[model samples]
Target: MEFWRYYRVIRRRRWLILLGTLAAVLMVVYWNYTTPTMYIGKTTLMEPKGQTQDGVPLFQSQMMGTMLDPQLQLSNLGNIATSQKVLSNAAQSLAELGLKMDPEDILAATSVHPERDTNILAIEVTLPDEQEAKVAADAIATEFKKTYDELNNQALKDSRNFIEGQINSTRNAMVKAQDALRRYKEQNGVVEINQQLADSVQNLYLAQTNANQAQINHEAAASRAMKAATELAKLPESQIAGTSISRNPIWERLSESLTDLETKKAAMLNGVPGQPRRGPNHPEVVALQAQINDVKDQLSKTKSDYIASTQQAKNPVWQTAYGNWFQAKVEDVATGAQAAAAENVIKKMKSEMSQLPAKEAELAKLQVDLKAATDTYSLMKSKLDEAKIRENQGSSEVALRTIDPAHVTEAHNNGLLKLALALVLAPLMGIGVAFLLHYTDNTVKTAADAEKLLGLPVLTAIPGSKAHSLPRQHCPEIMDVAYQMLTSNLWVATQNQADNGIVMVSAEPDAGRSVNASNLAVALAREGAKVILVDADLRKPTQHLIFGVDNKVGLTNVLSGGATLEDALALTRVQGLLLIPAGPVPDNPVKLLRSPEMKEFVDQVKEFADFVVFDTPAGVTFPDPVLVASQVGSAVVVHSAGRVPRGSEAELRQRLESIGVRLIGAVLNKVRREDSSSFFHYHRSYEGVVMPQLTSGKKAIKSGPRDQA
Candidate 1:
C-alpha cells in the first residue's frame, strides 16, 4: 500500500471524523455553561509600627524604648493581628454596619500571605459573593492594627518599670555604705598602740622569773658540788676518782641527803631561817632549829670549800647546771603575766564591737539588704506607672486608612477566565475526539494497515464523484476530476510496468464503481490508449447503460464459446475504446467467472488490446472479482469518497491479492467538496492531475450515452 492509497481511505472516512469532532465540541460547551461561579477579594496590610499619636507628656518618655523589631520585643504582632481575640473585637466593631455574620465565617474566608523583599502583608478573603468578600477583608485588616497598638503601649510600660528598679537600687546602696562608715567612726575612739607599756610589762615578768631562777640555780650548783665532794671524801681511795653513786650506796645516800639539806636551806633566805624564825616553833623545834642553824653555818663553810673542790672534779659540764628547776620557775611567772594581758584585750574588743553594731560588717549587710528592697520597690513603681499609661492608651481611639475602598463588581465571577478556558479546551477536545474515531473505526488504519491486512499494494487515490452528477446531466465536475485523476494515476502506475494494460474499476452496488469504470474508460481512450472496458461483475452488472452498449450478447456470450469474437466485442461510442458489457445477470457469477473459457477470453483480449479495464462487483462481499482479478493485467478499487465502508477497503484489497492480482490504484468517487479546504492537505498533489475542467475534453470524446437496460 502506498501513501496516496492510504490517504484515499481517510478521505472516504471523513464523515466519521467530522461527526466525532462536532459531538465532542458540543459536549464541552454544555459543560462549561453548567459550571458554578466563584468570587475573590483582597486587602493590603501595612507593616506594624510601635508608634503612638496621642498628645500626652507623662508616658511619652517611656515609649521611646518601644521598638517593634530588632530587639523583637514583639515579633508575634502578626499572630495577634489574626488572633481570635482580635477577630472578635473587629467583628464587634463592624456591628454598626448591620451585616450579621459569624466571626468564624469572616475569619474562615480571611488569609494572610507576607511578601518577600518587603514588609507588606496582603490579606485575601474569598466568599460566594464578591461584595461580602471585599467588606470582610477591610474589617479584618483594620482590627489587627488596633490590637497591635494596644499591645505595644503595654509593652512600653513593662520596659520603663524594668529600668527604674536598677536606678533605685544603686542610690539606696550608696546611702547604706555611707551610713555604715560614719557609725563605725562615732562608736570607736581614736586608737593608738602602747608599745612602751607592753615592753616594760614583759621586762618586769622576765626580771622577776630570772632573779628567782638565779637563786635556785646557785643553790643547786652549791648542793651538787658539796655532795660530789663529800662522796669523793667518803670513797675509799680506790673507787674515789670516778665511781658513780650506785657503785657505793652509803656514800651515794650520804651525798644525796646532804645535797637535799643544802638545797632546802638555800630555798630559805640567808638569815631569815637562821632559827627558821619566819613562823612559830615549839620548844623541841626551837632546839632542833638552833642545831639546824649551827650545822647549816658549819655545813655552808665546809660545803663551800668542798664545792670548790667538787667543782674542780673531772666530770663534764651539765645542761643549765640545774636547768629543769630554773626553767619551771621562769615559766610559772611568765604564764601568769601573759594570761592577764590576753583577758584584758579580749574584754576591750567585746565591749567596742558590742557598742557599735552599725559600724561593723553587720552594718554593711543591713545597708545591702535595704538597697535590694528599695531597688525592687522602684522597679515595681515604674511598672505600675507604665501600666497606667497602657490602660490610658487602650482607652484611646485608633485611626484607620484604606488603600482600596470596597465596591460591588458588575460580574460576580471570573468571567473572562472562564470564557477563555472554554474557548481553548472545546476545540482541543473536538480534535481529540476526531483522532479517537480515526483510531477506533477499525478500517484499514493506514496505507500500511491496508497493505498488511489485504496483502496487496494500493496504487492511487481517486477523488470521489458527486452523487448529484447523473440527475444534473453535467456529469458533476467531481466526476471529471475522478476520471482524470484515475487516468493519471494509472498512467503513472503503468508507465514503468507496460505502455498499455488491463484496468479494472469496482465497488459495492450503487457505489457507482461501474459509472466510475465507464468514465475512466472514456478518459483513457481520450488519451489514445486502445482500451477495453470489461463489465466483469456478471452477477448484477450495470455497465450497459454507462457505455450505451447492448447487453443482449456481451462477456457471457464471448466466454461461453457460443458467439463469434466480433459479436461479443461491441464498439463503444468512445474512439479507441471497447466494452464487453454484462449481457445478462448470471445465476452463479463466481462459477462463470472462474471457468476455463473465461480465462481464455481474458488472455485473448489482452493479446488484442493495449489496455483492459474491468468493472467487477465489490471485491469485499463477493468472490467474483477475485476470480476475475486473476485474469486482468491490473484491477483498481473504486471507493466512494467520504462514504467508504468501515472495513470494505481492507477486505476489498485482500480479496484481490489472495488470488494473486496486482492492484493498480483506487478511484474515490462521489467526493464531498464542502470541506474541501480542510481535505486539501490530502488532495494538493492531485490538483493538476484532474483534467483542466474537462469541458473541451468532453466534446472531443464521443462516448456512448447512458441507457438503462
Candidate 2:
C-alpha cells in the first residue's frame, strides 16, 4: 500500500482499531491487575562464566544479516518457556503467591524471555490478582535461576572430569622419557676432547663419545641449560662437542682455546723473561702468561698421549648409545621443558575444568529436579515476551495512549463544530430542499411563487385577522412599520392617478379579503383621503366584521330595491373612510355586482370618495376584483407575499387587466418577519396612525425647527 493509503486506513479506521485495541489492552490490564493493588519486586543476576570478562559485560556481535538468527532465539525462548514442564514449575513456585492453579495453568499464565543476550533471563508469572501476579513473577524468577545454574554446573563438572582423564596419560609419557635419558647418560663415558691440537687421538675419541652421548641425553637439558646459561661458555654438553671459546681470524687462534692460551703464555714468558721494566715476576702480564703456560703444558702433555691413539678407531657402542641418548633423552627432555612452559595455560584449563563437571552434573540434576523449573522458566519467559509484544502493539496499532488521550466527557468528538455546521448547513439545505420541492409544490409561498407557476397576479393580501391584539399596547413600533409599508406600497400604486382608483383586495376563497379591505380603508382614511371600503365580494360578504357594523341592511338590499344608496352608505369608525358592507348573503351575488345598479352605485361613491377600495373574494372564487379593476383608472394589485400560491400574482394581474384595467403597481403583504430577518423595516408614527415614507431614503428630509412648531 502507498503511504497515504496506510495513512487513510489509520485515519478512517483509527476509531475501530483504536477502540478495539484499547479494549484489548484494558482487558489485559484488568486481567493482570484488580482492586488498584500496588505491587513491587526486584530481581538480580550474576553473569555466567565466559559470558563476562573481569566482571565487565560483553555481548556477541549481533546484527540483522548475521547467521545467528537472534529473533529466533527470542522466539524460541518464548516457546520453550511456555512448555508444560516450565509451566508446572512456575505453578509450584506461585503457590507462595496464594495461587491455586495447576502447574500447567500457572505456566500458561506466566511468560519467559531473555533480556537481550546479556545472559539475563526474565520471567513473569501472573496470579489471579495483582499482588499475586507480582509475587508469582518473583518466585518464578528466583527458582528459574536456581534451575538454570544447577544444569550449567553439572555440565561443566562432566566436561572437567573428561579433560582430567586426558591429562594423566600425557604426564606419564613425559616422566618415562626423563628416566631413560638419565640411565643412558650414566653408562656413557666422559672424555675431555681438545679440538684445537694435533694431539692424542684416543683421548679425542673418548671425549667425542662422551660429548655425543651427552648430546643424545641432553635435548631437554640443553634447552633448560640454554635458558639458564647466560654467557654460553660454561655449558657442559657444548664443551664436550669441542667448540672453541671464541671465533678468531688468526690461524693459531683458531686452534683449541686451551692450546692457544698456553702458546701465547709461553711466548710471553720466554720473550719477556728478564727484560721487564720491573722484576720478571712483578709484571702482571708476565705472571698471567706464566700461569697459562704451565696449565697449557700440562693439558698438551696429558692430551698428546691419547689424541693420536684413539683417533685410529671409533667405538660403535658409544656412537649407538650417543644416538639413542640424543633421540630419546634429549628430545624427551625438550618435550618436557616445552610442556612445562605451558603451565599457566594448563592451570587455567584445570581451573575452568574444575568448575565444569559439578556445574554439568548439577545441570543434569537440575534437569531432573527442576526439570519442571526449566520448563516453567521457559514458559514464563515466553509469556512475558508475548506480553511485551502485546504492549508494543497497544502503542501504535491502537491509538489509545494518544498525545491527547480521550477521557469520559459530556461533549462528543467534534461536537461543537458539528453543531455549528448543522446550524448552518441544515437551514441552507432545508431552504434549498424547500425550494427544490417548491418547484413541484402546488401551494403558494408568495405571490411570485404563484405567478411564476400559474401566470397570474395576486390581489390583496389580507393582513391576518388577529388585530395587533393590543394595538399600540401590543407593539406600536412593529405595527406602525407594517402600516407604513402597506400604505406606501398602495400610494405608489396610485401614483399620478387618483380618479377611478380601485384597490382590488382579493384572494382565493377564505383568503380574508374583507379583513384586507377594511384595514386598507382605515389606512387610507388615516392618510386624510376619502376612502370607501366596499364589500363587493358577493359570494362571501365579510366586510361587516372589519367595520363592526350590522350587515342586516346593506349592499344586497340596496341593489335588490329594498333600500336606497343613502341608507346603505354608512360612516365607519375610521376617519375619512366609508363602509358599504354586504347586507346579507346573496344567492346570486355575482349577478347583483354585474348589474347596472352596481355601476350606478360605484359612480355615486366615486363622486364622493377619493379612493374606492373593493373587498373581493379571490379572483378564482368570484369575479368582483376583476370587474372593478377593469373599470377603474388605476389598480393596486395586493398580493399575499406568502400564503398565495406560487403563480397567484401573475394570475391576479392577468385577471384584472383582462377587462382592460391598467395596473399601476402591486402591494406585497404578509411578508414574513422572522423568516426574512435579512430585510429591515424601520418605522415612525403620527399618533396611533402610521405615516408612510413619502419617498426613498435619498429623497427623505428631516423637518426643520420652524416646521416642527
Model number with the top TM-score: 1
Error of 1 at 348 (Å): 22
Task: Give me the overall lDDT of model 2.
Answer: 0.48
lDDT of 1 at 163: 39
Q: Which regions of candidate 1 fall more than 4 Å away from where they truly are?
A: 1-138, 146-382, 390-461, 465-473, 476-482, 488-512, 524-533, 538-588, 600-612, 620-622, 637-709
Instruction: Note the Cα lDDT for every prediction shown.
Output: 0.54, 0.48
Query: Could you give candidate 2's per-residue lDDT for residues 129-229 as a string of tens digits?
Result: 55565566555555554454443344233323433443353344335544543454455433232332212222333333333233322432443234333
Worst lDDT run of 10 residues, candidate 1, spans 270-279
Error of 2 at 68 (Å): 15
Show the lowest summed lDDT stretch of 10 residues, model 2. 53-62
Q: Residue 616 CA error for candidate 2 (Å)?
A: 0.2
Against the hidden reference, what TM-scores do the models get? 0.44, 0.37
Reference-based lDDT, residue 643, model 2: 51
List the RMSD of every prediction in angstroms: 48.7, 43.9
